[model samples]
Target chain A: MKEIRVFSPATVANVNCGFDVLGFALDGLGDEMVIRKVPEKGIKITKITGAELPYKAKENVVGVAGLAMVEALNLDFGFEIEIHKNIRLGSGVGSSAASAAGIVYGINQFLETPLSNLELTAFGMKGEAVASGNEHADNVAPCLYGGFTLITGYEPLRIVSLPVPEELYVTIIHPHITIKTKEAREILPEQVSLKNAIKQTGNLAGLIAGLYEADYGLIASSTQDVLVEPYRKNLIPDFDFYKQTALKNGGLAFGISGSGPSMFTLSKGLQNAGAVEFALKKALKEKNMKSESYVSPVSKHGNRILEQK
Target chain B: MKEIRVFSPATVANVNCGFDVLGFALDGLGDEMVIRKVPEKGIKITKITGAELPYKAKENVVGVAGLAMVEALNLDFGFEIEIHKNIRLGSGVGSSAASAAGIVYGINQFLETPLSNLELTAFGMKGEAVASGNEHADNVAPCLYGGFTLITGYEPLRIVSLPVPEELYVTIIHPHITIKTKEAREILPEQVSLKNAIKQTGNLAGLIAGLYEADYGLIASSTQDVLVEPYRKNLIPDFDFYKQTALKNGGLAFGISGSGPSMFTLSKGLQNAGAVEFALKKALKEKNMKSESYVSPVSKHGNRILEQK
Candidate 1:
C-alpha cells in the first residue's frame, strides 16, 4: 500500500503495581494518522490538528519514531504524516505514545517485509524517549502489541503479551492539567526500602496472575502502587478522593494513569466502568477542574489500519 | 477420626525473582508426622525421631503451630504429635516449614470443622516465625496450598495459588553447610535502587504470567533475582559454578532456594531435570562438597494423609 491511515490507541502505563513494566491499551480512544509514501529519503510531518506540538521532523515524536524505523530498514523512500489527535498532550494517558506507535505501525505495513510488533515497539520507544527523556517501553509496547504488555527485561528488551480478561473495562479521567514526565519522575525516590520493594513485586505478580485467571477480586486487591505512587500522587489534585470515588463506584483498581494529571480505574463490566467514570467526572467537577473522561473496554488490538491503498 | 498421620512435603521458597512472596511445593521429599487426640487441651510432643528438636510444646515448631491452630479453634481437647524427620534442619529447603505445616495439616484433619488452607497457612506461619524470626508464608503457603503460591499481601494475608505445568520439574541440591535465616537476612541491604526494584518486579511478573501460560521459555527468562541473590550468593560456596552447570545442562532456571546451603533449579521435563541434577551433583563433587539432591515435579498437593485411625 502506498498510503495508509491508522488509529493508534491511548494506553495506561505503570498500571498501579507495575511501574516501568506494565501497560494496557484502550479501545476507541486515541489519535488518527494518515501517511503517504514520498520519493524523498526522510520523514516529514505535513499536518497536525487538535493539539499544538512541535512540527519539526527532529522535534516531533512521530517523525523521530518514523525516522528510527526507516533508518533501521535503510529505506530509500520517505513518508509524509498528517496527525489528528483526540488524546490530550501530556495527559499521562500516552498521547505521545499514540502518535509514535501509530506512525511506525503505518510504516511497517508499507514495508516489503513487515517488521514484528516487537520490532515496531523498539522504534516507537525512540519517540517515547523524545517525550519522556528515557527509553521506556511501558507505554509504547502495549500500544503496539495490544491488550496488556509486560516488559520483562530492558537490557535485551523482552516484551510479553498478557491475557486480557473478557469483562475488563477502564475508566480514565484527564484533568485539564499537565504534569511533565520528567518532573513527575524527579519526585520519585532514587532508593526504596526493601520491604516496600518486595510488596510491590508481590502485587505485580498477583496482578499478572489475576489477569490470566480472570479473578476480579484478585486484580482489585493486587492493583496497588508502593514504589512510585506516593510521591507522584501529589502531582494530581484530589488523587485520594478520586480513587475513593472510583472504588466506591465499583472500580476494580485505581491509580495515576502514567505520571499523573490523568488517572484511570479498572472495572469488571461496562456498567461498572460507566459508574466509575460518572463518579470520577463528578469528583473532578466538584474540585472545579475541567476534565475529559473515557470509558472503554481494554483494547484487544493496538495500532491498526483505518484505510489503505 | 481422632488420630491422623500426615506427610508434609518440602517446599522451595523465594523461587528466584519472587523473594518472600513466591514458592512451590516439592513431591516425595518431606517429613512424616503422627498426631493423636487426647482429653487434654494443649499440644504435646510425644516423641522425636528424625532430628533433635525441643520437646517442649512452646519451643517446638510442630507444637507451636498446632497450638496456634487449636487456640484459634478454641478446642476442648489437645493433641500429641510424634515426629519422624526427613528434611534436614538449616538446609534452607524449608525443613522447618515441613514440620510446622505437617503438624497443622494433621491436626486440621481431626477437627470436626476443619479450617481452610488459608487459615492453616496463617497458623503454619506462626511456627515459621519461631524458626526464621519472621512470619513469612512463602514456604508455608506453598506447603499448605500445594502447587505454587504467591503471597500477594501480608497485611491482610492474601495467598494465591498458581498453576503448575505438567512437565515442570525441580532439582534441589543441599550442600552440607548451614546459613541461619537471620544471619542471611542481615547480609542484605535495607534499601535498593529503584532501578533494580523495577527490574526484579518485571522478572517476577513475567514469571507469574509464564507459569499461568506454561510457557517454559518465558519462565526461564523471567526467573531472575536481583534484590537478594547478589548479596546472598556468597554464602553458598561455588554458587556461580553450580548455577552455570545447571543452566548448561538442562535447567530452565536456577537460584538459591531460600537463603543458602541449598540451591534449586527448575527444568522442563523429568529427563532434563535429572540431567541438571547429575551435572549439579558432579560439580559439587568436583568441588569436594558433600551434598544431597532430589528431583521431582512441582507438587500438586501439599500435606496429605499417610495413615489414620
Candidate 2:
C-alpha cells in the first residue's frame, strides 16, 4: 500500500494508584492521520486540521514521530502526513500521543514494513518528549498497544499489556480549563515517605489483580491513590466534588486522568457510566464551570488502520 | 466436632518488588495445630513443640492468635491448643505466621464458627505482633487467604487474594543463620527517593499483572526489588551469590523470602526448581555455609483442616 489512514485512541495515564506506571486506552476519543507516499525522499507534514498544533516537522508530534520512525529504520522515504486531531490538548487525555502514534502507525502501514509495538512506542515517546520535555511512555504505550498497559521499565522500554475486564466503561469529564504538564509535574514532591510508598505498591498490585480476575469491587477499592493525586488534585478545580459525586452516582472508581483539569471515572456497565457522566456534569454546572463528558468502553485495540489503498 | 487439627502453610512476604504488600503461600512447609474443647471458660496453650518458641500464653504466637479469635467471636467455651511447628523461626519464612494462622484455623474449625479470612488475618496479626512488635499482615494475609495475596490496606484489614499460575514453583533456601525481624526492619530507610519509589511501583504493577496473566517472563522481570531487599540482603550470607547462581541455573526470579537469612527463587517448572535448589545449595557449600532447600508448588489453599474428631 502506498497510502494509509490510521486512528490512535486517547489514553488515561497514572490510573490512580499506578502513578507513572499504568495506563489504558479509550475507544471514542482519538486522533486520525492520513499518509501518502511522495516522490521526495524526506518526511514532511504537508497539512494539519481539527486542532491548533505545531505544524513544523520538528515541533509537531506527528512530524517528530514520523522522523523518529524513519531514522530508526534507516529508511529513505518521502511522506506527506495530514493530522485530524480530535482529542483535546492539555485535557490529560493523551492528545499528542494519539497524533504521534497515528502518524507512525499510518507511515508504517504505507511503507509495508511494520515496526514492533515497542519500537513504535519508542518513536512515539520522542513525540511525547517534544510535547512534555521528557521521554515517558505511560500514555504512548497504551495508545500504541491498546488495552491496559504497565510501563514496567523505562530504561529498556519494557511495556506489558495487562488484561482488561470485559464489562468496563470509562467515563471522562474534560473541563474547559488547561493545566500544563510541566507545571503539574513541578507540584509533586521529590521524596515520599516509605509508608506511603508501600501502600501505593499494594494498591497497584490490587488494581492489577482486579483487572485479571474481573473483580469490579477489588478494582474500585484498589483505585485509591496516596502518591501523586494528593499533591496534584489541587490543580484541578472541583476535583473532590466531581469525584465524590461520580462515586455517589455509581462510579466504580474515580481519579484525575493525567495531570488534569480533566477527570476519569470507571463504571461496570453502560447505565452506570451514563449516571456517572450525568453526575459529574451536573456537579460542574452547579459550580458554574463549563465541561464536556464522554463515556466510552475501554479500548481493546489501540492504533489501527482506518483505510488502506 | 469437639477437636480439630489444622495446617497453615508457610509464606514468603514482600515477594521482592512488593515489600510490605504482597505475599504467597507454600505447599510443603507449614505449622500444625490441634485444638480441643475444655470445660474452662478461656483459651489456653497446653503444649508447644518442634521449635524454640515462647510457651507462655500471652507471649506465644499460637496462644496470642487463639486468644484473639476467642475474644473476637465472644466465645464462651475454653480451648486447649497444641502447636507442632515445622517452619523455622528467624529463618525469613513465615514461621510465626503459620503458627498464628494454624491455631486460629483450628479453633475456628473446632467451634464450628468460622471467621472471615480478614478477621482471621487480624487475629493472626496479633500473633505476629507478639513475635515482631508490629501488627503487619503481609505474611498473615497470604497464610490465611492462600495463593498470592495483596495487603491493600492495614487500618480496616483489606486483603485481596491473587491468582496463582498452575506451573509455578517456589524454591526456598534457609541458611542456618538467624536474622531477627526487628533488626531487619530497623535497617530500612524512613524515606525513599521519589524516583526509586516510582520504579518500585512499576515493578509491583508488573508483578501483579504477571500473576493475573500467568506470564512467567513478566513475573521474572518484575520480581526485581529496589526497596527493602537492598538494605536487608546484607543480613544474609552469600545472598548475591545464591541469587545469581539460581538465575544462571534457570530460576525465573530470586530474592530474600521475607527479611532473610532465608532466600526464595521462582521457577516455571519442577525441573527448573530442582536445578535452582541444587545450584543454591552448591553456592552455599562453596561459601562454607550450611542451608536447607525446599521446592514446592505454590499452595492453592491456605489454612485447612487436617483432621476432626
Candidate 3:
C-alpha cells in the first residue's frame, strides 16, 4: 500500500474586487489529507470535520476532485482518503477547497504527474464544481499556488499568479454560521446594469494596475464593487462598519469573503489588521451577533504534505 | 485673449473584463479645446463642429471639467472656450469626454496647477458627473493618464496607469448608428447573480494578471463578461459573429467599447489586426450591417496639444 499525505491551505476566494477570479491562501488554517492506494480502482472516503460535510466517497467533493485526477492519469488506482478539516466550513474559508486541493496535490504526487501550478489550479476546481455545482477557481487556485491568483476567462481557464507585497497583512472574521454557496448564489442578481458593469470592470482594472505598481492606495480605493456586493451584502452583518474600519484602520481593502457570514481585509501590517478585526468585532457585537476573527499575513505557501495530527 | 489649445485622445473603456475601472486611449481621434483668457472671471464656450451639444458655457460638460482645473488652482480666470470636435459623437466613442479632457488638460496647463495623474483623473471626471450626473472616472482617467488606467474605487477616487505592453494592437469597429449610454443602461438589471459576478471578477482578475505578465493568451481568455453582455448584446447587431470573426482572425480579446454601436478587439500585430478587420467586415456583411474599422496600438498619450487644423 502506498500512503501519501498532503496539506492545503484555507483560501479566501473572491478577494475583494476579484469576485470570482481572485483568491489568496491563508498560511495557518486548512485541511490535511491522507490517501492510501488499495487493491481497487475507486474512491473510499472519510472526513474529520469542523463543519458538517458529506462523507460518502463518490458523493463527496474531494472524491470528485480525486476522480478528475485519476481520469487525467488514465490509471486504475483504488484510493482510501481521509480528510481532516481545520478551517471553518461555510464561513468563506474554503472548506471544500481544502479537501479538493489536498486530494489533487496528493494524487499528483502519487502519480508523479508533471502538472504545472496553473494546471493544478484547473484540476483543483473540479472539486469546487462538485461542491458548488459551479466551477469556481478562486478557492482552488489560491489553495494550489498560494499567495494571490487571478483566474481569468472561465472557458479556457486562464490562471495567473500576482506579486504579493511583503507588507500586506490579512484578517478574516467568521461568524460560525454555514451559508452554503447555493444560498449565497441565489441571493445574487440575474443581471447587472451596464453602468455597474463598466464600473466593476474599471475597478478590476485599477486593482490589477495597483498590484503591478504596488500602489496600496489604488488597491484600497479600487476594491469597491458596484455590481454584486450591493445586492449580496444584505446577507452579511456589520458589512458597512467592517468596510469603514478596515480603511480607517489602515487596511488598503476589505470586503465580504467569498459569499457570506465571513469577511476579510488586507492591511499594510498586523497592527492595522488589528484595527480591522476590532472594527469588525465591535460592529458585530453592536449588531448582537457572535463572531470570531483572525489576523495574519498573506499566505505565501499553498498545498503540501503535513505530519498527521 | 490667451488661447491655449489642448487635444484629448478618444478612449476605449471597459477593456474586456475591466468592467468599471479599466480603460485605454486610441490614437488619431479626440476632441480639441482652445481656452482663452477673457476679461471676465466666469466661463464662455462655443462648439464649431460635431453634432449639437450642450451650448451654454457653465452648463456644458467641458466647462464643468474646466471648473475642476480652476478650482484646484484657486484662480478666478475667465476663459472663452472653443471646441474642435474630432471623434464622432454617440458612436460608442467618448465624445463628451474629449471635450472635458481637452478643456481640463488645457486649463490645468494654463494655470500651472500641479496635480498627479490620479488627481487630474478625478478632476476631469467632473465632466462625466455633469453629463451622467454620476462622478464616474473610467473614461476621464484614461483620457487624462493616457494608455490604460484602472479605477479601483470611487468617492476619493483611486486611479493608476498600467505599463503599456510592446506587442499590443487595438482594432476598433465603429458602426454608423449611435447607442445612447443612458438608454443602454436602462436595459440592464438592477441586480446580478453571484455566479455571474464571480465569473466577471474572475475573468477580470485574469485579465489584470495577463496585463501585468504580458501574457497574451491569458489576456484573451480573461476578456469575457457573463453579467452584462448577455442582456445588452441584443442591442448590438451581429455581435457574436463579429466576436467570432475577430477571434478567428488573430484577435486575442473582444468586447463592446462602452455602451453599443461600437466594438473593439486587441491583437498582437498589424497583420493579425488587418485579418481581424477583414473577418469583422465579412461577418458584418453577413449580418447586414456596416462599420468603419481602425487598426492601431494602445495610445500612451491621453489629452495633448496638436497643431490647429
Candidate 4:
C-alpha cells in the first residue's frame, strides 16, 4: 500500500476509582493521521493541523511513535506522516495518545506488518514518554484497544480489555483551559491512608463487576474516587459544580477526566446523556467559562484504518 | 418450621491484592448451626461443640447475629441455637463469620421471612462486630452469598457477588497457630505509598476482569498482593515455602487466607489442587508443624439450609 489513513479515538483515563489503571475510549473526539511511504529510509512529519503541538519529528508524538515502531520492527522503508489532531492537548482526554497511537496504527497498516496490540502499545508509550517525560499506558491502551481497558501491570506491560455495557453513554465537557499531565500528577500525594486505599480498591472491583453484569446502578455507585480526584479537581474550573450538576440532572456517574480542565459523566441512554450535557454546559455557562461538550457512546474500535490507497 | 439447620461456609478474606475488599467462600470448611424456636421472646445459645466458645447470647457471634436479626425483623419469638464449629478460630479463615452467618441463616430459614441478602449481611456484620469490635462484611458477605464477593462500600453495606470460573479449585492449609484478627490488623501500616496503592487497584480491577472472563492466566497474574500479604505472611509458619511449593506444584495463586496461620492456594483443576495440597502438606510436615488441608471447588452457595423440621 502507498498510503494509509487511520483514526485513533480519545480516552478518559482513571474512570473515577481506577486512577492510572483504568480507562475507556470515546466514539467522538479523536485524532486522525495519514501516512505515505517514501523512498528514503527515514521518518518525517509533513504537516500539522487542529492543535498547537510540536512539529519537529523528534519532538512530536506521532514522529516519536513512528520512529519507535520502525526501530522495533527494523523497517528499511521511510514514511511521512500528516497529523490532524482533533482531541485537545492538556484537556485530560488522551490527545497525545491519539496522535501517538494513530501514527503507529497508520504505519502498521501501510506496511502490512501489523504489530500486536501490545507491541503497538509499547511504541505508543514511547510517544507518551516524549510528551510527558513518563511512559504511561493508561490512556494509550484504551485509545488503541477501544472500549474499557485495565492496565493490570506496568513492569511487563499487561493490559486487559474490560467489558462495557451497551447502554453506556459518556458526556464530556472540556472547558477552555489547560492542565498539563505532569502538573496534575505532581500534585498527587506521595502516600495515601490505608483506609482510602481499601476504599479505592473496593470501588475498582465494584466498577469492574458492574461492567461485567451490566448493572448501571452498581457502576454509578462504584465510580467514586477517594484518591486522585480530591487532589486534581482544583485544576479544573468549577469541577464540583459540573460533577454535581451532571449527577443531579440524571448523569449516572461524574468525575474529572484524566488529569483535569476536562470533566466527564456517564449516563445510561441518549436522553439522560443529553440532559447531563445540557446541565453541565449550563453550569459552566453560568460561571462564564467557555467550554465545549461532546456526547458519545463508548467506542468499541479504538484505532482503525479509514482509507488506504 | 420448628427447627432449622444451616451451613455457612468459611471464607478467605483479602484475597491478595484486595485487602479488606475481596473474599471467596470454601466448599467444605464451614460452621453448622441448628436453630430452634421456643415460647420465650428472647434469643439464647443452648449448646456449643467442636470449639471452645462463649455460650452467652450477646457474647457469642451466633447469638449476636441472632439478636441483630431479631431486632431488625421485630420478631417476637425466642430461639435457641446450637453451634457446630468446623472452621478453626484464629486460623485466618473467617471462623467468626461462619458462625455468625450460620446462625442468622438458620434463623432466616426457620422463620421463612427471607430477609434480603443485604439485610442478612447487615445482621452478619453485627456478629462480626461482636467478634472484632468493628463491623466488617468482607468475609461475612462471601460466606453468606458464596463464590467471590466484593465489599464495595461499607456505609450502606454494598456487597457484590462476582463470577467464579468452573475450572478453579482451592486448597487451604490451616496450621495449629493463632493470630488474632485485631493484632493482624494492627501490624498493617497506617498508610501505604501512593505507588503501591495504585498498583493494588490495578491488580484488583484485573482480577475481577479475569473472573468475569474466565481467564485463568489473568487470575494467576493478578492475584499478587503488594499491600497486606507482605506484612501478615510473617504470622504463618513456612509461609514462603508453602507458597512457593504450591505454585511450583501447579497452583495458580497463593496467599494468606485471612489474617494469619492458615494459607490458601488456587489451582486450575482437581489434579493441580491435589498436587498443590500434597506439596503444601509435605512442606508443613517437614517444618514439624501440624496442619490440616482441604481441597474443594469454589462454593457456589454461600449458606444453605441443611434441614427444616
Candidate 5:
C-alpha cells in the first residue's frame, strides 16, 4: 500500500493505584491520520485540522515519531502525513500519544515488513517525550496494544496486556481547564512514606488480580490512589465533588486521568457508565463549569487502519 | 467433634516485590497442635515441647490467638491446647504464625459453626502481633488461606488468594543466625523515593499477573525487590552471593523470605528447586556458614485437621 488512513485511540494513564505503571485505551475517541508515500526522501506534514499544531516535521509529535521510525529503518522513500485531532490537546488523556502512535501505526502499514506494536511503541515514546518532557510508556503502551496495559519494567521496556472485563466501561470528564503534564508531574512529592508505598502496591496488585478474575468488588476496593492524587487534585476544580458524584452514581473507581484537569470513572456496565456521565455532567453544570464528557467500553484494539490503497 | 489435631504450615512472608503484602505456605515444614474441649470457661495452653515458650495462657501466641477467637464469638466453652514446635523460632519462616493459626484452626473445628478462614486470620494476626510488635498479616494470611496470599487492604482486612502454578517449587535456606522482626522493621526507611516506589508497584502487578497466567518468564523478571532489599540484605551474610548462585542454578527468582536469615528461591519444577538448593548449600559451605535448608512445592491448603474425635 502506498497510502493508508488510520485511527489511534486515546488512553487513560496513571490509573488509580497504578500511578506510572498502568493504563487503558478508550474506544471511538482519538486522532485520525492519513499518510501517503511521496517521491521526496524525508517525512513531511501537509495538512492539519480540528486543532492548532505545528506543521514542521521537527516540531509536531507525529512528525517527530514518524521521523524516528523512518531514520531507524533508513527508508529512502518519503511520506507525507495529514493530521486530524479528535482528542483535545493538554487534557491529560494522552492527546499527544494518539497522534504519535497513529502516525507510526499508519506508516508501518506501507512497509513490506511492518514493525511490531511493541517496536512501534519506542518511536511513539520518542514523540510522547516531546510533549511530556520525559519518556514514559503508560500512555503509549495502551494506545499501541489496547485493553488494559501494565508496564512490567522499563530497562527492557516490558509491557503486559491485562485481561479486560466484558462489562467494563469508562467515563471521562474533561473540564474546561488545562493542566500541563510537566507541571502536574512536578507538583508530586519526591518521597512517599514507606507505609503508603506498601498500600499503593497492594492496591495495584489487587487491581491486576481483580481484572484477571473479573471481580468487581475487588476492583472497587483496590482502585484507590495514595501517592499522587493528593497533590494533583488541587489543580482541578471541585475534584472531590466530581469523584463523589461518580462513585455515588455507580462508578467503581474514580481518579485523575493522567496528569489532570481531566478525570475518569470506571464502571461495570454501559448503563452505569452513562449514569456516572449524567451525574458528573450535572454536577459540573450546577457549578457553572463547561466541559466535554464521553462514555466508552475499554478499547479492545489500539491503532487500526481505516483505509488503504 | 470435641477434640482435634491440626497442622499449620510454615510460610515465607514479605515475598519479593510484595513486601508487607504477599506470602506463600510451605508443604511439610510446620507446627502441630492438639486441642480438646473441657468444662472450663476459658482457653489454656496445657503443654509445650520442642521450644522454650511461656506456658501462661496470655503470654503464649497460641493462647492469645485462641482467646481472641473465643472472645469474639463469645463461646461459652473453653479449650486446651498442646503445642509441638517443628519450625524454628525467629527463622523468618512464620514459626509464630503457624502456632497462632494452629490453635484457632483447631478451636474452630470444635464449634458447630466454624468461622471462615478470612475471619480466622484476624485472630491469627492478634497472636502474630505479640511477636512482631505490629499487626502485619503477610505471614498469617498465607498461613490461614494457603497458596499465595495478598493483603489488599488493612483497614477492613482484605485478603486475596492468588493462583499458584502447578509446577512451582520453593527452596528455603535458613542460615544459623537470628534477626528479630521488630529490629528488622525498625531498620527500614520511613520514606522511599517516588521512582523506586513506582518501580516496585510495576514489579508487584507483574508478579500477580504472572502467577495467574503461569508465565514463568514474567515471574522471573518481576521477582525483584528494590524498596526493602537494599536496606535489609546487609543484615544477611553473603546475601548477594546466595542470590547470584540461585539465579545461576535455574532458580526463577530469589529473595529474603521475611525479614532476614531465611532466604527463599522460586523455581519452575522439583528438579530446578533441588538444583538451586544444592548450589546454595555449596556456596554457603564454601564460606564456612552453617545453614539449614528445605525444598517443597507451594502448599495448596493452609491449616488442616490431622485428627478429630
Candidate 6:
C-alpha cells in the first residue's frame, strides 16, 4: 500500500482591489493531509485533525471534500486520512481551504487524477458549505491552482490564473489573535454606497489591466479598497501602520487578508521580503501586540504531495 | 463663427449584478446641447433647456457640467450655450449625465478641443454633483465618449474604452410611464444582507469574466442581481414579461435599466436581439402599454459627435 502525504498552501481572497471577486494562494502557510488506500469496503475519515475541528467526519473540513470524490468516483476501497494544520485558523489565511485542498488533492491521487483542476475545485467548494456555510471559491481555487487566480463563475471553476508579475512581492502579517470569519462577516454593511461599488469596479479593472499590461504602478494604485476595508480595518491591529510602513519600504499596496486579523501588502522592486516582514513586526509590536509576518512570492501551484511511503 | 451641436446618451450606473460598481451607456436616450463660439471675451448661457428642467442657468443640470470645464482648464472664452432635451428626462438613464456630457463636450469644442476626452469626461461628471450633490463618472463617461467604457477608478477616471464584442447585442424597452430617477433611488433599502452582498460579488465576478472571455452563456447566467433587482423590479411596468420574453428569445442576460420604466437585455447574437425586441413590443401591446423598443448593439463609442458644423 502506498501512503502519500501532501500540503496545500493557504490563500487570501479579495486582494484589496478585487474584493469578494479575486483571490490567490500562498506558497508556505497551509495544511497537510495524508491518505492511504486500505483494503476496506468504503472510504471513510480515520482521524479529525491536529487541531480540534467541528462536525466530526461530516463536519470535517477536508473530509467532506474527500467524500465528494468517493461519491463521484464510486469508489469501493476505503482510505485513511489524516490532516496536519500549519496556517493560523480563522486569521483569514485560508486555513479551511488548506484542509479542503488536501482532501481534493489526495483523493485525486487515489482516483488516479481523473478530475481536472476545475472539476476538483468544484467538488472542493462543496466542502466550503461545511466550513463557512457558503460555497465560496475565492480561497479554494487559488490553493488548488496557485498564483493570482480570478474565480469568476465556479461551476467548472472557470478560473483565470494570471501570471504573477516579476516585480511583485507580497508581505503577510498574521496577528496572534482570533477574529472569527463569521464575526468579520457579521460586521459588514448590508448595502455599500453606489460610489464604492463603482470605485471597486474601476480598481478591479485597473488591477486586471495592471496584471496583463505589467503596469506595477497601476496595480498598486488599484489595490485600494473602500467597501469592506473601512468597516473591517477597525478590527485589525496596527492596520494603518502595517500599510504605511510597508509602502514606505517599497510595498505598492496593502489591505486586510480575507476577513482579517491577518493583513497583506504588495510591493514592487523590493527583493528582501524580510524587510517588509520586519516592518510589519515592528508595527504590531508598537501596538502592544505580537504577530508573525511572512514575505513570499505568490504561490504558483496550489496543493502537492511532499512524501509517500 | 461656427455652431457645434451634439447629443450625449444616458447611461446606467451600477449595472444590475454589479451594484455600485459597473455601468454602461445606452443609445436612443440622453440630453442634447448646442454651442457656438465667437471671437469674444466672455461666456454666456443664452438659453436653458425648455423641457422639464431644473429651472436655472447656473443651477441648471447642464450648467454645473459647464462650470466643471471652465474651472478645469482655466479657459475664458466667449460662447453661447444652449441645453435641449430628448432622452427620458427623469429616467435613471442618466438624465442629468447628458447635461454634464453636453457641457463638457460644448466647452471642449468651444475651447477648440483643447482638452482630451479624458479631461472632458472628468469635467462632465460634475453634473452628477448637480443632481445627487456628488460627482460620479459611470453616467458621464459614456455620455461624453459615445460607446461602452469601463470606469476603472475615480478623481481622474482610470477609464478603459473597450471594444464591444461582435456577438453582443442589447434590446431596450422604454415604457411611456414615468418614474423619476430620484424616487427610484429613494426606494432602495437602507441595509442589505451580507449573504446578498456575497452573492452579488460572485455574480459581478462572473459578469466581468463573461464579458472579458466573450462567454455569452455565462454572461446570461451571471446577470442575476440578488440585492437590487428584487426590490427595484417592482417599480417597472410589466417587468416580468419583458425579462422572460427577452430570455425566452436568444437573450444572454436581462435586467432593469438604471432606475425604472426601462428594461434591457444582452444577447449573444443579433437574431436574439431582434426577437427579444419583438417580444417586448408584443407584450407591451398586449398590455395596452404604450412603449418603444430598440435592438441596438452595445455602443462602441460613448459620446462621439456624429456631426458638427
lDDT of candidate 6 over B1-309, digit per residue (tens): 378777777676666776554667766665667777756533556776547665454677676777656666666555567777776565566778877777677667656556877887777776777776677777777666655566666655666654456678777778888776677778877666555555565566566656666767667677788777887887886687778887887788888776767777888777888988888889889989998777777765666564578
The whole-model lDDT of each prediction reads 0.91, 0.86, 0.76, 0.87, 0.91, 0.73
**Tens-digit per-residue lDDT, A1-309, candidate 3:** 278778888888777667777788887777888888876886778545555667776678888888877777776777888877787666788888887888878777766546787777677788878777887787888888888877765666666778887778888888765676777777877766555665666677667667677777777767777766787777775577667766787778878888877888888777888887887778777778789888878888898776432
Better of 3 and 6 by DockQ: 3
Give the TM-score comparing model 6 with the true structure, all chains together.
Answer: 0.82
> Residue B191's C-alpha lDDT in candidate 3?
72
Off-target runs (Cα >4 Å) in candidate 5 are: A38-40
- Docking quality band of candidate 6, CAPRI definitions: incorrect
Error of 5 at A47 (Å): 2.0
Please give the distance, in angstroms, between residue B19's alpha carbon in candidate 5 and its true position after superposition.
1.0
The candidates' DockQ values read 0.86, 0.79, 0.40, 0.86, 0.86, 0.22
TM-score to native of every candidate shown: 0.96, 0.95, 0.81, 0.97, 0.97, 0.82
Tell me the lDDT of model 2 at B126. 93
Write the number of the candidate with greater TM-score, choosing between 1 and 4: 4
Cα lDDT tens digits for candidate 4, B185-224: 8889989999988888888888899998889999999998
Task: State how far residue B302 of model 1 sits from its true place (Å).
Answer: 1.4
lDDT of 2: 0.86
State the lDDT at B116 in candidate 6: 75
**Chain B TM-score of candidate number 5:** 0.98
**Tens digits of per-residue lDDT for model 2 on A1-309?**
678888889999998988888999999889888898887755788778888877788888888888888877777667888888888788899988888778777776755556889988898899888888888898999998999999998777799988889989999999998788888989999889998888888888888888988989989988889889989998887788888999999898999998887799999998999999988888999999999989999999998888888
- CA lDDT of B144 in candidate 4? 87
Instruction: Compose the digit string of candidate 1's lDDT tens values, residues A35-111.
Output: 99999998989899999988898899999999998998999999999999999888888999998999999999888
Stretches off by above 4 angstroms in model 4 are A111-113
Candidate 2 segments whose C-alpha is farther than 4 A from its true place: A74-77, A111-113
